[model samples]
Target: MGANPRGCLRACSLAVRSCLRSFIDEAGVPPAFIVGLSGGADSLALALTVIDVASRAGIEVVTLTVDHGLRTGSAHEARRVADLAASLGARALVETVRVDGRGGPEASARDARLAALRFLALREGAPVLLGHTMDDQAETVLLRLARGSGPSSLRAIAPIRRDEDGVTWLRPLLGLRRADTAGACAQAALTPVEDPTNAIDGPWRAADGSALRRSAVRHSVIPALASALGVDPVPALARTAALCAADDDALSEWASGLLAVSCEASPAAGEGSLALVVSEVSGAPRAVRARALREVASRAGIRLLSGVHVDALDDLIVAWRGQGPIPLPGGRATRVGRGTQARILFEARSPEPTRDGG
Candidate 1:
């Protein structure tokens, strides 16, 4: 893994082939694969490689480019990706989505993009594929760490995600590097567009440098860490994510059982909302208690919870004295009891509930 570009590209090609084949072997054969392409090097390389391999397995491949329409050339970029995907023997499709302005453009765009991809998977009966690399995983872990996240947040972006519709989204390039993706694309004589958002610095960077957290981590934080530590920190961060993911899985499983016993088993606060016995929560271990609170809030549609939120909710249980209520974002709140009941009621925000979270 030297700085030799061509060698990296060759290694990346082999790695992508292995990961994709393994996914197909484990998940069984799919009628087709819907790859979420962005005209970026990582996705372009993945699309081309999967196209070649899936065709050999008698499986069809289709590429969907999400035109976010956030930037000036975004639609053109999608068109370019669709054209390249078509040239690579994969059917190409394009869709436009309106990104909400909340939670920053990146997060809002991501949620919108995933919604579109999930829709495609359900409607077309195929799993969606993403081209997230190890670098992306590293950045995610770093971001979560900064936010004082728990073990689950440190788990970072998962390699595979299965939605409610039973559609599985795959990230075959999770183990690969960003540099290698570009290298691989170069090797095959395919030109990939450089997404302005992915640019680390210079003119491409936003005037407000901190506007995009991912970009800042990718360009500033990562480079600073590498310079200070005298080594590449991305791989170590990614490895930490893998270890944390396993731990999160175990904790979540245990917490699920604890929640079942502790919860009132009734949606007393309305749909997508539930109540938990205060005594049961107080009697549980801090970790399990935190998890139970996490579970309840997650069910109540709070997706972007941090350790701060978890501790605050736990305080309502273990550290309770006379605190009336604890505040949860998205217009939700938690109170110790209502009327004669000694249980905590978790409520959803607004008329309809948001279906997000673990």
Candidate 2:
């Protein structure tokens, strides 16, 4: 709609075009692609660029604005975003989700939003595009690091992820900074909705009056680090995430291969039961072994397997001293043999019988 300053709009358009072209080359062109628009600068810029790119390719763009219903006037904000999308010649939908607050408010809202996006993407057989920027990536890595996360956890916010249910999630803007998106929005003569919760000292706060974790990182920690080092820390932190992602990918591949060779499902033990060759697993490095064990536990129908559970399982392999059955989330792991024939058995615990028979 207007001239781009410093080519921010052009850069975003090029990035979207490249990502769409790559996906098309792999799976052929779809009728449409879905965009998660929140009326924010980042999503607005993404919507503009994607609309431009899809127009050229004769593809339709559908934007979904989710209202989490966490605050007042959320429905109005959703309508505003949908109106903008409709004005730009794209189909718009507003999804209202209830945040159960199972996790913290922030996390629960995200989960609800993602679930809505995934449902729409599946129904339309399209890819879902998000507006996560390099700044978001840096914040994610910093937050995970503060939690003492390992390499796999540190490889945060993948640019492209394909879920098990065949939903493709794409974040083409991860290479661009937050400022670039804001500039792009300005270039397009679009005024973005400023959500107060994103502000450093906004209305959202913890019980102790501290800002939200991400907001605090974005406004305070990142700037403080930059001031201390006399350099922008975002690029370096983003680079670290990229490096960790590469390493994690390699290790994951290796772990898969190791599992294929050293693990087997026991038919006699029924479903959700597997056995791992203790010697083969113990011979591998700790990093690869840890991943393999996690995979094994997942296959055994164990959900939410924590580090403590994994470590205890690992000890059964390396630090074995005739320990008893180690209980897991949904099952138990026990060593069944000794010497070279040792096998770690992961079996789902049988459901207990009801007191009153049906």
Candidate 3:
């Protein structure tokens, strides 16, 4: 295993082959040729492992590294990542992106990184591989809990997500720990760059609190749980996430059925509108109501709404009877009136003149 990267690759391949095969077999989607390389241990290991798999499966490989330019030496780091990818026999693409802290630095950087990866995938006409590991999942769950979020938050990050655009995001290393990846890099004699941001005291540090809790989840929680329960906590949590994902899929499908008729109307009319009699929508199952509101907001390109906002929309939907509009985030909503008709208005684009509009 130390001499041959194939050994570590084989281990990962066995663990993830079923997951990968299912996506391809059922969805008729092939393994994507694009791998995201951040020059970090996790992503480097992922690229090496992916190259090994591609060698066996006879697939082309393209590596993409995004330079966010947030710190000095970022460009050099991206170049190094590209070189490593090329050494591993992947066609490397280096993309330099500007990060505007519109949503704060970290969030903006993440959004930009994802957008870059998605752009690469679109241009290449393939799915994109992300290098999220088991530790990231645990961290996400803890962060969500800290924020007083719901059980759905416990489900945390996903292993795979297919968007409406047919581009698939795959996380093949979600089953591996960060330690395992670091060990693999050492064994492979790979010098993966360490991102300074991971160690800095910023929003991530503030959220995790003192770096001790963050390290505990990495070093303590899984081991303590294994000691007491006789099994790895991460694997167990991954399974729980899988079940939750399935449940979410079912709920989403049910919501789609409920929305089919109302959404089939002209996009302008029903794009963000739901037309059941006010009585019907109000009395619909709670899950159904939440799903419908989420779908509508989604169609209208509004994603800032939180769980509380969704709940409020549900309440409003059930209580409405007259023509006045039900308020929603991003200045969009459904106006319900007499009879069965409802108008979905993009308040941002509505021609109604403002006090200052001349």
Best by the TM-score measure: 2
Using TM-score, rank the candidates from best to worst: 2, 1, 3
**What are the per-residue Cα lDDT tens digits for candidate 2 across 1-358?**
4334247888888778788998899989987989999999999999988988888789999999999987899999899889999999789999999999776677788899999999999999999999999999999999999999987989999999999999999999999999889999988889999988889777767657788899999999999999999999999999999999999999999999999889998777777699999988898999999999999888888767899998999999999999999998878998988888899999988776788852
Q: What TM-score fits each model?
A: 0.81, 0.95, 0.77
At residue 172, candidate 3 shows an lDDT of 82
Worst 10 residues of 3 by lDDT: 342-351
lDDT of 2: 0.90
RMSD versus native structure for model 3: 4.8
Total backbone clashes of candidate 1, pairs 3 or more residues apart or in separate chains: 0
Summarize candidate 1's per-residue lDDT along 179-208 as a digit string, tens digits.
888888878888888776666552333336
**Candidate 1: which pairs clash?**
none
| lDDT by residue (tens digit), candidate 3, 144-238 | 66688644556778788888777888888888888777877877789999776665342344343554355455556656867999876776666
Better of 1 and 3 by lDDT: 1
lDDT, model 2, position 183:
92
Residue 295 deviation, candidate 3, in Å? 1.8
